[model samples]
Structure formats: C-alpha cells, structure tokens
Target: MRKVLESLQRGAHAGLVLDRFGPLAPTDEKNLPERKDRHLTAVLEAAGSGATRELYALAFERRRSTSDPELSRSFQRSVDGAMVIGLGIASTLEAGLRLHQTYGVPFVPGSSIKGLAAHWCHRVLGDDRGGEHREAPLWRKEGDYHRFLFGTTEACGAIVFEDAWPIPNSIAGANGGLRREVMTPHHLDWQGGKGAPTDFDSPTPVGFLSMVGRYDFRITWNGPPAESATIAGWLDRAAEIVSCALVDWGIGAKTSSGFGRMVEAETGNRANAIATVAVAPVGNRADKRSSGTPARVTLVAARPKGGFDVQEEGRALGTLTLGTSPAGLSPEIGMTVDVQVHNDDPVKPQYKWPVASKPAKSVPPSKRR
Candidate 1:
C-alpha cells in the first residue's frame, strides 16, 4: 500500500489519500508515531499543486454563475486564526478536517456560513424570542425579513450562501491552505471521572489538520424578479451581518478557543455594497401612525448591561433600555407590552412605552406556572 501511494504522481485526490491510504499500526503493535506523521505530510503535499488551483477556479466560476450576475456578490477575506472544521469526523488519526470531496481542497461549507449568519442575526442583532427552545424569532413568521433571507422549516430561503474556497497560492507554504495542528490532553484520568489529575500523568499529543489563508465568499439572490429590490436590500444587510459574524463570533469548530475567526482582506478595495431599495414598514396599518407608532413588543431576553432585548412582529427593534419602570410594573421575560416606535431614522429606530401601558397576558408556557 505504501509503495502504491508513493508511486502516485502529484495532484492526487487528497481526500482519497487521507481517508484510504493512511498508515495503520499492526494488530500486535499499538502505535506507530512516525508513520502517522508521514501519512499527514502526504495528504498536505497532495493539496499543494497547480491542479488543485485549477480545480478550485472551475468550482468558483460555476458557483458565481449559479445566479444572475446582477444579483450575486462575492468578496475575499482571510482567516484570522487557525480554523479547525469537522474535527469530530471519524478518522484513523482521531481528528479530521473537512476537505473538498472531489478536488481534495480546503473549503468552508455553505451551510456553515449560513448557520453563522443566522445565529449572529438572532443573538447579536436582537431578533430573539427569549426561550431555550425558541431562539429563532425571525423563523416563526413566514413573511419575516429574517425568514426571507434564511428560510423557515416550511420553505427555502430567497438567498443562497455558497461555499468559500481558498485563493490560489495565497499562503507561503507548499501545503496550500492546510496547516498541521496538535492538541495535548493533560488530565486523562480526571476527564474520564476515574481519579484526580496529578503531575505525574503523561500528556497525549493528538495531531490534526486546520486551515488558514484567504477565501472567496459569495451570496446570491434567488427570489422572484418582482421582489428583487426588497430581497436585494435584505441581502445587503445579510452580507454586512455575515462579515461581522465571521470577525466577531468566528465560525467552524472550536471558536471559543479562537478557531475559525476571519477578517476582510487588506487589499484597500472592497466589492460594491449591494444596492438597497426602500421598503415599506411591514405590520398592521395602525402601527404606522405619524406621531409615534404603537407596537406590541415581546421581552425576548435581558441584556447583560441593562434593559431588555425586544422584538416586534417577529422583527428585532434593538435593545429597550429603561432606568426605571412605572410603579407596579415589573418587566419579565415572554411578557408583551405596548410601546411607541419612532422611525424618523430608519437605520436606528427608537422605542418608548407610555406610563399607562402595562404587561399583556402573553407570557410563555414555562413562565405561566
């Protein structure tokens, strides 16, 4: 097997090599440390060729042309730190990295990109329902903007998030976008719940693969032409939100430990922001009054600093901060109340509840008891 692998020329499929050709220890012998290292090196080297670059180019062209030219947008960005994706995937080496199935290249999955964007939109942007089970407030309504961008359980979304592929020869090494990484587990006994960790225990160093370098991210509008203008506006907002999510919240596996963070490329130029069309406020006619529109908002979640995160008609209206509420009025989660909404500045709207307004009887099932 080793000789057959060695005879294979450059540009062989990396996924095939890693998955099938990986060296394994004999039944009698437990570990062959050097053999595993050599196998990983082979996989990395297989991805570092002009053939992989050409394959990625073809894939990128197909993805870009999947939607209309006018409705699609693409941008370049670089991973800020090591990105470990699909680490839990079963493999002989114990850790695994997601690679392109056919081309054997490192690429970010489209589902991952959309998932991160949706999470950022709900959590950071305040489009939440304030419950353990119902975190996606925007997905509740069929016509909600969030639902339009990122579909509901019933229908598909209007926009398509494409996988991000690495730029040709972006990194200095021969491994292309692939990087070797290691994780040392120190407290084996304590983790197994057998005994307390001691200094005398030996640490096991596990090897894995990660990714770094620039990648092209693309998003396209896939809705009807009649709704193109409105969908385009939402797509513009989504692109910005996705960028913020990648930089702030990160993506892929092990984000809390600083994996999968990305930032815009420092090329001093950016793709033109998607053109936005003016959209009429969506909701009841009475909610659009001139003086100050009255709205029934739900207390989604409490802010860490002060005040509550409120949502109206399944749309996030930003944070509602109040120094003090009227007497006999105590704010609670899942409670709905009437508030006056001022949209003079459409970008950032203001919310004000009258002193007469009181909490409505819309408490969540858990809160009722």
Candidate 2:
C-alpha cells in the first residue's frame, strides 16, 4: 500500500493521469508520526482531481435517482422501500484503514451497519437471552424471521444495508464542510507493545481524517412474501433501532474519546423518509431499463473535472463521467460516441458509452492525443 501511494505521488509529479488521492490510513501504528498529515493532504489532493469529482458527482446523481418520487415508482417490483438516514461522525471517528478501493472515499461499512443494528436490537431492545443467542443456530429450515431479517450463517438477510457515504458536494473542506482531525496517542510503547514505553514514552500523532459532514445512509428491503403489515412493522422498528444506535451508541472507531457520534439530518426521520418503491418485476423490467438500448451520442464539452457533456443530435443530453468514453472520443467537441441513457433522478440525467472505435486514420495522432 505504501508502495502504491509512493507510485501515485510519482505519477502526479510526471504529469501522468494519477488516480484520485485519498487518505490511506496507515496500518503500522509504529510509524505514527507523519500519518495524520500525509493522509489528509493526499485525500484533499485526490478529491480535487476531475476524475475523482466526476465519480462522486455521478454516485450522488444515482442516489438522487433512487430517491426521486416519480422515477422510483417505476421500480416498484424489485425495490421495497428506502430511507435516508443521516449521521454525523464525530472528529474522533476512525474509519480504520479502509477507503473506497476505487474512489478513496471513507465510509462506514455495511457490516458495521449490520453490527449497529444487531447491537441496538439485542441490547437496547432488552433481549433477555442477550447476544449469547447470536451463535446459536436458528436451525429451522424455514429460517427464524429475525435471523432471516438480520442474517445468520444459515441464510442471507432480506435487507441489503449499503455503506454510509459522504454526500456529493459535502466532502468539501473549506466552506464549513469536512474538517481534518488529529489523533495523538500517548504511551505508544505500552500501547503498541502491550508493555515497554510506559508513562515516560513519547506520544505520537496517529492520523488526520475529515470529520465533518452528515452522511446519508440508505437501506433497501429485498424480501420474502410476508404480510405488508408485518414487513412495515419490521421496517419501522429496524429504522428506529438504527437511528438510536447511531445517536446513542455511536459508530465507527473511538466513540469513548468522542469520535463517531452523529445526529440525524433535519430532512426527516426514517418514518417520513421512508418511501416504497416496487422492485421491477422479473419479465420486461430489462426493457424498461435505460441501458437495455444504446444510442449514439456526440461529445459537447469536456468538463474540467474529468467528465464530458454529451448531446444527441443538437439536443443536450448530459454529462458522462470521465473514462466512460473510449480514447477515440478525443478532446474534440463534436466527436460522436455511442451511449446508453443512465437512469437519473429528476435532477441531473446522464449517460455512459462504450469506448469509441479506434481513432480514424484520417485524424492526426496529435488530435487523438
């Protein structure tokens, strides 16, 4: 990992198209001195890349699409309902060493969400048997409803918990957005070695990560043929537990030092935020999907931030996240590229296209370049 970061730094120096930069949290605790500074700087630099920004923008757009009132209605068969749960991670939140492998963005994993849910359910809900039953086999071939909902070794759960991510435009640092944080751990030798450098040991700064922002957390229900009333009740209880767990119990690393504590965003609570959308039924759902049919499009503009504006004929279409087009698309404004409409929210619509045919022999290499 260190080698990878070093290579990217070299690429940036050589004017190469460096992939996005992100704070790659260090795993070796011994080398703690420069971890914080290096991480924050790298992430800021990476986030500035047009390619990186484009990915975030597109992701945000897709998220918005899922939440759109009218558009979401189309997927009524495959989807159950969705809730926008917002959370604020305290400055001390240590998301560990993981970042989105592709985007480099920090996120709370779905596993953590599952854990948070289970913790709230068994502990807060006052399960008399306690978490001890967690290991016990549900054993029923039909599966325990609670076990089926949350999942156990015997079966997968009915719900899909997505990673909680930073909302697009929300990761910005300067204008009251994300703030870099410092973690200084004292008595490193004792802590690091489990003995040794005692009170006399020097303290070291661990890392600096962005702590600001109320991230959106989305949960989707993919189900069994349960009664609507039963499913609705379960969803209600689950959302409540998750909300309480995040606020009351907190999340991520370092809650005791005041890290990972977050409150719900003002938009709405789970009950109001919840929206039912049917998952498109199996048959002609593919026909209804935008990607099923591809259309040829022309490039209108190359966004400075690593994406291209597209048009079909003279009509404006939308933005294509960088690298979505083939190298043949070139930097020219009028180049044609085949594309498929990407499903989007009522807000911003976009499309993605296959790599263009090899650059025409008539075009100069410089033009292609």
Candidate 3:
C-alpha cells in the first residue's frame, strides 16, 4: 500500500486507486525510488470503457461534489453526456487542483452542480432574492416545496446530487488535456473601501493552477415532484434552464473572467470511434501506418516497466506496447511520436513506429523561405 502511494507521488503509473477502492494507506516518498518527474494525470485500464460501466463503479463513493454521471444517466433527453466546465479549484495543492482520488481524473462536485441548478431555477422564475411574497404549496408557505426540496437548518434536501466526472478522452480541441491557468488578485492591501490603488499595491500573480476541461453531470431526481407536470417534464425543464444558466452565469471560482461556464457535449464522434474499435475485425484509420503513413500521436503516459497509451489526433488509439525500438528509449509523458499500425493483429493490433517522432513540417520545401 505504501509502495502504491509512493508510486503515485513519485511519478509511477501505479494507477492511483479511487477513494472507493479502499482507504489509501499512509506512505512517505523518502524511501521510494528517486525519480524527479511530474507525471501526466490519467486513469487506469478501465478509463475509456463504456461510461455506464465506469460510473456504476465510481458514482456513490467519497465524492466532494454533486456531479455524479451515474445519477444524470437516469434522466432522458439531451442532458446525457452533458458537460459542466471548471467548477473551481479548492484544493490542498498550492495551485488548488482537485482530482478524483482513484483515477486522478478532475471533476466538479455534485453539490456545486446542485447549487448551479437551484440558482438557475430561481433565476428563470424571477424569484432571485427579489423579496417578493406569494401563497402556499407551489408558491411557498411553511413546510412548502422549496423548503421540502432544498431543506433547511433542521433537515436535509430530498434531491441526491451526484458527483460529475469527465468523459474519458473528452478533451476538446488540439491540446485536449488539463490546463494550468494564472489568477491574479490586485489591490489585496486594501480592505473594504478604506484604501486606494497605489504604487505599493502591486498586482499579485497567483501561481498557475490546474483546471480540467469540460465534464459530464448527473443529478438524481429524489427531490419534489412537479405539481403541474410529469416528472419527465420537470426534469426536461430543469435541464434546459440549468444548461442555459451554466452558459450565461457559469460556476466556481472565477466567473467574472469566465471560468466555469459549460454546455452539453456532442459526443457523437467519440461514440462512433468507440463503436468502431469494438466491432472492427481488422482495418482502421491506423492502417495507413503500414503504407508508411506517418502521423503524430501524443504519448499520455508510459509504465516504467513496459507499455504506454497513444492519443492520435485528439483521440486515444489505445495503449501500444513499447516493443524493441532502435536504441533503448525510455517513455516520457507528453512525448509526440509519428506512428501507424504496421499490421492487422487479431488482438488490438500493436502499432510499430519510433517511440517518439516529429511532426512532418506542413510547409512545402519549395515554399519554405
């Protein structure tokens, strides 16, 4: 157990066990192997399987937030595979990065998501702290819907908010991965309206903090049932309102500069890719490599003992076994290699190429100045 924690801290792909896996025994890095490396945060063997499979195992355990993907799946319609962007970084790390204890995957707590939903609900109804009064049941009286639904100092809310998890390999755009962003707090010396901006009040640049990409959300519908419509209608309306709220107001730490805004993710392409991988008997896009098709793939992580994962063109092409490459080359995270599958092996064909390679220069030789 100590060895595994040591592996996690010391840049080893021990596949950091999630909190549900069991309590992580205490360990110190002092006795572990001396390897000064900052490893890329990723998941274990089951990272990119069906979302349902992963969520069922991870949903209810040791989560800090209400963003559970498993709970969200129960609802019908477009909210499935929906995204909730950076909810904020409240962490022990100096830079304040939060991750799933087991998979090292970043996420937004379901509690925060619930807050977003409630905020959205209130905003749409024009009851956002307006100090307006109305009647019973739907309109509010003692032991009314709001109190019953959201709870009070004496009771807990009926709704069960679930922790949100990122869809594996759902990083959008070219450099789809965790990003470090800088936050600066200016005029920290002034308290209230007591002080004015001066030369002494230099801008303080907080260290670059890590933030994750878009994520999927799931919130259970154990709260109050709609007085007027079916549960489905209630959920649909709530989903629509909250989705808009996320985009308009955003969530988490820095909203003025736009930090936690999110929208539904269109995962069709990824879905197709996963399906292709499951059904394909032999041929695939990676087939071009046999014909000497050279493409750039980012190596996410490599096991100190053996294999590593390859993400080509913003998509994970599965882990490739690090066979005997020319010269003894060790694997490193964030290394790019030009590669393609050399042959059609029945069992997920392992591609052959240099452990690392450079991108072919786009400019034609004649066009180069």
Candidate 4:
C-alpha cells in the first residue's frame, strides 16, 4: 500500500482512488515475486467486461455583465453544468478603461470571457456546428452499453458545474463580496464616458486591467486502458459537448474571437489541458469467463448533466481483474494528463473537511444490500 501511494505521490499532490477490485494481498508472506505479475494479470483479463460507479467534475470561468441574457440562459439551461462569470462595476471607470485597452480590444466585456469558456467546451465536444444531439448524459440506465456492446464504436459523456456566469457585471458585483476593488470592462461607457475617447492614451491601467480569467474541467471515469483509441473515443465526445455550450453564447469554432485558456493550478504545467481519465472497479459479480483474471472494462468519469448520452449499466468502461498484471493494465494506465493553459495566475483557497476511513474488507456479495 505504501509503495503504491509513493508512486502516485511522485506525480500528483492530491489524488483519489477509483473503481477497485479485491484479492489484493494484505502485507504479508502471501507477497511473492509472482504477486506483482499475478496482480497485473488480473487487471488485464478484465478488459471490456463491465464494472461499477462512474463519476466526473468539470469547472470553467466567465466574465460577463449582470444583465446579459446569455449568462442566465446558460445557467438555466445548464441543468447538468454550472458557469460563473466575473462582473463588478470597476471601483473607478478610468481604472477599468485602462485595463480594457491592454487586452488588444476596445473593451473587455465580461460577456466576452463567458462566451469564450462556453466556446471552449463546445470545441472540446466537437459540436461547434450545433445540429446533432451528441447524447452526453449525466448517467444512463445500464443496458444501453450492451446494446451496441461488441460492435460498439461510439462512446458518450457529460459536463456540469454548480454556478453559471453569463455576463461581466455579475462578476464585478460578486467581487466586492470579497471586499476587493471592483473593476471590469463593460462598466466603461467608451461612447460617452469621462474619457471622451475609447482608445487608450497610456498603458498603466491597461497592464493592471489585464485581469486573469479562469476555466476548469474535471472528470472521474471508470478505466485505465492500454490504447488511446478508447480514450480518444471519450475525448472526442467530450469536446463536442463543450462546443455546444459555447455556440449557445454565439461563439463559433476556430474563431480567434472566442478564445481563452484552461488552468490546472494542481500542476504548474500550463498547456491546453486534456482529459485525465482514472479507473476503479465496482463490487463483485466477477469474471465473465474462467480466465487467469476477471474481464475488466474501461470507463471515464463525467458529470450526469450536459447532453452527452451514456448508459448507466453494462457500459464497457473497461474490465476489472481481481489480481494485477502490468502488461495488460492498458497503455492508458499510469499516465498523466496536462491541461492547456498559460500565465502564472494565483489561486484562491477554499475550505474543506477531513474524512474518516472505512473498513477494508467487503461483506460477501450475497450480503451487498
């Protein structure tokens, strides 16, 4: 147990354990050279069979004014996903104006940032055109996965958040809640403000005005696979969903007009972030066939909202083998995913509570209920 945790700590500061299988030996004489090989073997044997519980968490940021319809609509329609935008009447319009001009635009309306993130999701989902229903579900009732089981080439997914910010003014108002100076682009009325002219005369405020905008996407899934093929299948679908969300904001695909970055403070690395898929197995009902290991399936975790459709049961998230083997653990296993981003933005800390431990062993399958 310490070895496994050590290996994971080498890479990430925080981590969560996903679908699990039993038969892993407690530290003891039962440990053998064959033990590692045996464990790997068990994991590989389970490919494409099915297992239990899939989850995901995705987050993004927006800058918009309080009155934008897009912000409200995005949240109202975001039954599965949530969005938050920055909006604050700059403590001083002159300060806000200086910041706006620095971004190479006449104004940095909060709505524009909000639209950028929505568009980002749209691009990720590959649905920029917005014609088809890409079937990204929060979770589906089980049997659907088996319907296309053996020959199934397509996969489904979903996205969600707890809040939606469709405009810049909204963020400005919220900012004061933190008791900081409120400043945003939209609050500046260039056509008729104190400046008389909209363009910048100097760069001081412009530099300070360049506030950092942020977006976050997190997902929990059910597998670690040996190939990118399956992961791609999931990613392609996820990208499509993000695209649709952006389109709703009137942002089009491949447009410089709609752009922003994905920040993962969890790691200092800042590149366009991609999916970080993890795996865990469900409770027993093991081994589809009497093989050295039980057949395992690979599954990615995602929110239950958004429109991506997926089945709740029998979806081959990848298989689970009771024992472990390195070779067949799936090439996709033990890999790190980095999000695409730029800028060294500071992060705010949030409150959290400590958790208690649980009993290690499972009761017999017969007594699961």
Candidate 5:
C-alpha cells in the first residue's frame, strides 16, 4: 500500500490519498505514536502541491462565473480562524477534512451553509409567541419570512445557497487551501469514563486538517419574476442573516471553540446589497480620505510566514508586513490598530505604520548633593 501511494504522481486527489492510501500502524507496536505522527505529516505535505493549487484556482474561477449576475448575489468572506468541516467522517488518522471531490480543495457545502442560516433564523430571528414557557415556533404560519426563504417540508425555497469555494491565493501559505492543526486531549481516560479527570493525565496530541482563507458565498433567487422585487428584499435580508451568523455564531464542527468565524471581504459593487452587507470600505474618496490618513484596522489572523492579515471594519485591508512592532505594540489576532493608509491607488491601498505620538521626556530629578 505504501509503495502504491508513493508511485502515484504529484497532484493526485488529496482526499483519496488521505482516505485510501494512508499508512496504518500495528495495534501492539511500541512505536505506534511515532508511526502515526509520520503518517499525518506525510499526508499534510502530499496535499499541498502546486498542481493542486492550480486545480483549485480553476475551480474557483469556474464556480464564481457560473452564477448569473441578474439572478444571483455573490459575496466573499475571509475566515477569521481555522475551520474544520466534515470532522466526523471516518479517516485513518481519526480526524477528517472535507474537500472538493473533483478539485480536492476545501469548500463549505451549500447544504451546511443553508442549515446554519436556517438554524439562526429559527432561534434568533423568529418572533416570540405567547406562552411563558414557549418560544417562537419554527416559523409563524402567517407571512413567515423563514418559510418563504427556506421553504417547508412540502415545497422548495425561492432561493438557492450555492457551495462556497475559496478565493485563489487567499490562503497565506504554501499548503493548497489546507492547514495542519493539532488538538490535545488531556483527559482521555475521563472522557472514556474509566477515571476522573486530573491535571497529571498525559495529553494526547492529534493532528488534523483545517482551512483558513477567503471563501466566496453565493445565494441566488430562482422564484417568480413578478415577485423579484419582494424576493430581492428577502434575499438581501437573508444574506445579512447568513453573514451575521458566519461572523457571530459561526458554522461547521467545533464552532463553539471558534473554528469557523468569517468576516466579509471588500467588494467593488455596492449595487448588490446582499454582497455589501457587512463589508465597509477602508478609505473611500467620498469620505475625503487621502494618503497617510490614520484608519483603524482589525487584526484578523497572523500569516503563516510573517505579518498579519488586517481588515478595516469588516473589509479586508490585505497583509500588513512589519519588520518591527508599530508604536512598540505587538500584533495579535482580533486586536484593532490604527494604520496610515496610502491610497494613491484606491484599488490597491497600502497600510503604513501610524505616526507615533512622541513620548513626553522624563524630567531629570534634581540631585540633592
């Protein structure tokens, strides 16, 4: 099996390799842990070749262009942290990753997206009914927005949530759309119900595949043309709900652990209200913004190599490379920092270190000789 896996040329389907060709360790082997580590490392390395990247790029392009401008509203989002989908799927390594069957790239399934939105609508948006012990039903029977948008068990919805694919070159790493992650379980015996959890328990570190990058989400209206205006309003609202859900509640496995949060990326067109819901322009000319204007940007994530992926409000401001800490402040995820914008070209704005306020000179104490 190992020889067969090695013989396969580069760019082979990563999902196939991980699921089918992964090396196994003997149960009684003394070096089982070492073998497992080696196997996971090899799998991680094999999954991120140049050929796979090209394939992902092609797939992204094709998917992005497929939705009709008139019928569909598309938006892009940058993942705020690591996202793991299909984590329960059986795998030799005990952790699973969902990848595109054809392109072998990480993607958010449309069904999953819809499910998250639906759940959010039911729990958060649904209006409260009467009873003291009661909450809002799945949806109200009369003029139910949820029913119209997501549809009932009897009928299909007016809108379709398309599968989300990553933006090309968005993931800041050599790895093709995937990141290697580790999970350490400290109380395995407690979890197995064999013993009480204690600090002295040995921690088992398990490696898994996760993703961090920009993902393009699309939702299209396919209902009656006569009702387009009404549906468009609903679609816009739906987009906002989904955006809020992605950013707040998150999606996919381990969301409670902050695994799938995403923020809206900048878009050129404001006409598509659905796409422009959460994103804010960095320094719009209409705002009388000029070069070197200080702007507050949020640190989204640290780049694998160096620097940090920063965003203004929800709009992505691109990677900020710093040879030294600005104002002697270290960059950390989710921290907001003020930066000077070099907006000579509005399309490709550059962020510079904020003009540091000079510190007050300390007064020399008079010597009492």
Candidate 6:
C-alpha cells in the first residue's frame, strides 16, 4: 500500500482491476465531467459492469442443501457479482482519493477495500454454526463452501499480473504486483489533439485515501417485505461499523507512507517549522521502570528556537526550548508527549523515517522487526 502511494505520486496510473462476478449495466457518464487528475483517471479505468453474486456463492453456498448443478450456477453468479463489485469499489475509491488529494487531503486505499471485504467474509462464515470452523481452515474438502471461499485468498489477497495479456496501460512492480495505473487527460481523445497518448506514463500522486467498504450476508425470510427491509437496515449498520474500523486501524491507504498526519489542517508550508516529539515509555509500568533507571533523557527537535510544544491528550505538557546548538535537550516531564510546530507559510514536511529502505542492521536486534 505504501508503494502504491509512491507510484501515484510519481504520476503512474495505478490500475486496480477486479475479477469476480458478472457484468453490470453501463454507467451513465453523460452528466459526469471529464476528470483531469490521476486519481479520477484511475477510477474511470477501474469501472466494471459485473456483479459479485457468483464469487460469493462459490465461496459460501455449497454448504446449503442444494444440488451441485444448482450451486455451481449460483457460484458462477457470485463470481460475476464479486468482480463487478470489486471494479465499482475501485472506481469509486479512485475518484474519491483523487478529490481528497486535490484538496490536499487523503483517502483510503484499494487494498484496504479488498482486506475489508475479505474480513467481512471471514466474520460471516466464522460466526455461523453447524459448519466447520468459520475461521480460514486449510485442507478444505471438495463441495465444502469453506474450501471454495477461503481458497480464493491466494488469488485475491494481492494484485498480480499476466505478461501474455496485460492492461492497456498498467504499471508493474519489479516482482510484478499490479500497481495503480489509470488513464490520463493527455490520453483522452476528447481533450488532446491527434496522436494523443492512450496510456499513462506514470502513477498518480496520492494525497489521501478514501476507505470504501461493502458486505453481503444472508437473512432469513418467510417472504415478507418488512423482513427484507429489516435485513437491509442491518446491512447498513454493518457498513458503518466497517467504515469506522478502517479509519481506526489506519489500515487503508490514505497518504504517503512517511508523511501521513494525525491532524491535517490546511496550514501553509510546515517544513520550515521545526519538529519536536516527546518520547516516553508507555504500556506496563513494570516494563517502563525496569528499562529506564535514569531520572531523565534528552529529547531533540528539528530546529533551534522554533518553540516546539508538547501535549498529552488535550493538556499542555510544556514548551520545548532548543538550545543554540543541535545537541539533545532534556525533557521536563515523564508523561508521553506529542510535539507540534507550525508556521504561517507552507513548508515541505521532513520526516525522521527513510523515504525508501528496510530496517538497517546498524540498529540493535530488539529495534528490528
């Protein structure tokens, strides 16, 4: 997901093509305006006319008291439905992310959409009784829904590509994970002159990601419309919960890896402003006491005299005074600290994390994940 953001920022059209169910009706784009940003382009490319019914049935319906032929047909429908849903989700998220980024914000990532969908399946199956364990179980038996449903994870969990036949303008990772590659205005015949490019030259810049989630579950019905409506209402509630989970976990792709912000106010350039962070041992008190015997340890900020401030929850911890030199400065308290430094002018934010690199061996083993 971090790599996806980098790809977009570099001007690549990150394509997320979903393969699941049958085709859907053509969309009415006549009223839709031509989008200029990379994000919108990606969404348009992701649009699919399929339903997810087939994939869902194949993965969940074999357990029913239906015959193989009937279930097989249902499974096919589920596949078509899943594919269509996947494409629609991809398109919607692509557009939403582009809009957020254009406004200098972030939206969730497509990978998150997949993860949420997968989890939803896990939950529905896991909670069901009279079936094998709902959690993903290996060695699924033939005709077992568990085997069919969980079996697709290997195909759907990660985006992959085929060399023989590829997307018209798809981007590929070194190991060939399909990256976000959408169409661009330059490639649109409606805007560009003759010989206009038909594909993306680079991935789009991701400002933020918009998290999109959908879930499908069966509801018992004795043939009453009111019961059906009740089921619909329950699904809505589930959707809301899924949205909350995505936001809480930071599980969705929303911003550049190292540059994501907990609080994103439209302040001017902030890079020029110094950054200071309060570091305190948290979690178990016993663990904190055993590791740290020192009364205090020095904390550092990015700049001198930028007036870095610290806070915990909403209370003011204290001001961080940087000395004339770049040497470490001792903190005043023991509480966990959050530092803030902002200026009137917009500045490119700098990060302590490397832009691109894995854990270095220079660090101790305990520090390495």
lDDT of 5 by residue, 146-176 (tens): 5556766755666799888888788536676
Kindly provide the TM-score of model 5 when superposed on the true structure, using C-alpha atoms. 0.64
Residue 14 displacement in candidate 3 (angstroms): 12
Best candidate, TM-score: 1
What are the models' TM-scores?
0.66, 0.50, 0.44, 0.23, 0.64, 0.18
| Per-residue alpha-carbon lDDT of candidate 4 for residues 194-300, written as tens digits (9 for 90 to 100) | 55543654322121122222222222223333244444444334333333433334221212333222222234333333333111111212323222222223233
**Candidate 5 — which residues are off by over 4 angstroms?**
1-11, 127-143, 267-369
**Residue 315, candidate 3: C-alpha displacement in angstroms:** 47
Q: Of 1 and 6, which scores higher on TM-score?
A: 1
Q: Please give, for residues 90-123, the per-residue lDDT of candidate 6 as tens digits.
A: 4433332222221111123434443553454344
Per-residue lDDT of candidate 3, residues 150-214 (tens digit): 44565455455566665544533222324545456677767447688686776755543334454
Residue 60 of model 1, lDDT score? 65
- Ranked by TM-score, top first: 1, 5, 2, 3, 4, 6
Ranking by lDDT: 1, 5, 2, 3, 4, 6
Preferred candidate (lDDT higher): 4 or 5: 5
Error (Å) of candidate 6 at residue 335 is: 61
Global lDDT of each model?
Answer: 0.66, 0.48, 0.43, 0.26, 0.66, 0.26
Candidate 1 — which residues are off by over 4 angstroms? 1-11, 29-31, 65-67, 127-143, 171-173, 192-194, 267-369
lDDT score at residue 217, model 3, on the 0-100 scale:
54
TM-score, predicted candidate 2 vs. hidden true structure: 0.50
Q: lDDT tens string, model 2, 184-215?
A: 77886676568876566666655444444656
**What 10-residue stretch in candidate 2 is worst by lDDT?**
71-80
lDDT, model 2, position 192: 58
Q: What C-alpha lDDT, on a 0 to 100 scale, does residue 24 get in candidate 6?
A: 29
The ten-residue window of minimal lDDT in model 5 covers: 268-277
